[model samples]
Target: MVVESGGNARAGRPRAASAAQILEVAAQIADDDGLEAVSFRAIADRLGTSPMSVHRTTGGIDALRRELVAALVGDAIKAIDWPTGWREMCRTFAYALRDLLMRHPLVLEAHRQSALEAPGADDIAHRVVRALRDAGLCAEEAAYAYATLHDFVTGHVSIRLGRGDFESTTAPAERRGASVFVDHHDYDRRFETGISLLMSGIGATLAPRIRS
Candidate 1:
């Protein structure tokens, strides 16, 4: 490892590691000590290279963070056993996403910033929307459902991450008084409940209208 004024400068020429190696080490640091700790300097020290090499390989630290988050979420999504049925598929996806974000809370910010990178593009959006349409919702309704489910899952993670810190932003309820809302911070139950409500509402919206 290099042990310099900035980091630990060692005696040998820094070991030549690829971008993949840099990413793997950076992920380790992030997993162990949060994303804030996974700096270029930190990754360089771990890889026994200069921060400039890490930077050139990754384009920049921000790009590295985006790539790492994208890789992780994309892989995790691929690993899920996506159910054949729409409702079940939705539930499976919701749980999988929540589990992943809970493990790596920092990735959510990167996810939002990068459009969840490529995973949020065709892969996820297509399946969910098509499933919603198959479940009897029209294109417009399917679009809304997609937006709602994505917002719900991301909102759940954000709430847990920024709960007490965001108390002042909660809206006041007449019966409940000025309460910091989070459905009692029970996301496990709330996620399932939201899915059920979404499916049920979608079904209702598809009901035939009565003649005047």
Candidate 2:
């Protein structure tokens, strides 16, 4: 049965499919091929429907792109089931977002020109702010910390994933030279160290003000 734009199918009409479902299919198209492949006509072809049918539900390509970004961010947030503490939660959330972006590299490109005021973005930002405040950071400190953590995680993941270097290719002697001073270590340790360094810097900067 065909889905209508309003979410509910009219009497005698096919059952209405959710925007989420449409976005999911669109996301698959984007993820598998790239965001450029996520046109209304493409989605319609994937769904075995006419381009007009998809356009009627999604409004247009721009609307579909917006919905796709929202869906991806929402999915990333949902995947983060961290522990109670603010630091732990932030770490988990950061890693989860990194993983999601790495898995869906197209999302990184899609959000390049988009504002961060989207629904899921706002919710994630609020959560980060709340977590930082709970960790004894002031609003300004929390904002800075959030930005720093996001930049580090996103930048690291983008580099790693974009280079397609999850698997090492160098020999043992070459691998040892990869680290200038320290010995070769697991990637997870490197990630944790980066997160810890950021958290420590934030704590140090805010401690004086917070204690005053």
Against the unseen true structure, what C-alpha lDDT does each candidate score? 0.73, 0.72
The Cα RMSD of model 1 versus the native structure comes to 5.7
TM-score, candidate 2, is 0.75
Q: Write the per-residue lDDT of candidate 2 for residues 1-212, one digit (tens) a residue.
A: 34334333333444434566678778888888888888876765555556677778888898788778777777677766757867787888788877877888777877565653345677777788888888788788788888889888878876676655534544366664665533544566778889999877877876787788
Show model 2 residue runs off by greater than 4 Å. Answer: 1-21, 170-186, 206-212
lDDT of 1: 0.73
Q: What TM-score fits each model? A: 0.74, 0.75
Please write out the lDDT profile of model 1 over residues 1-212, one tens digit for every residue.
33223244457665556877877787778877878787888988876787887888889887888788877877787788877877777777777877888777767766666566656546777788898888777788787888888788889878876663344346445533544443464556667788789777766676653111
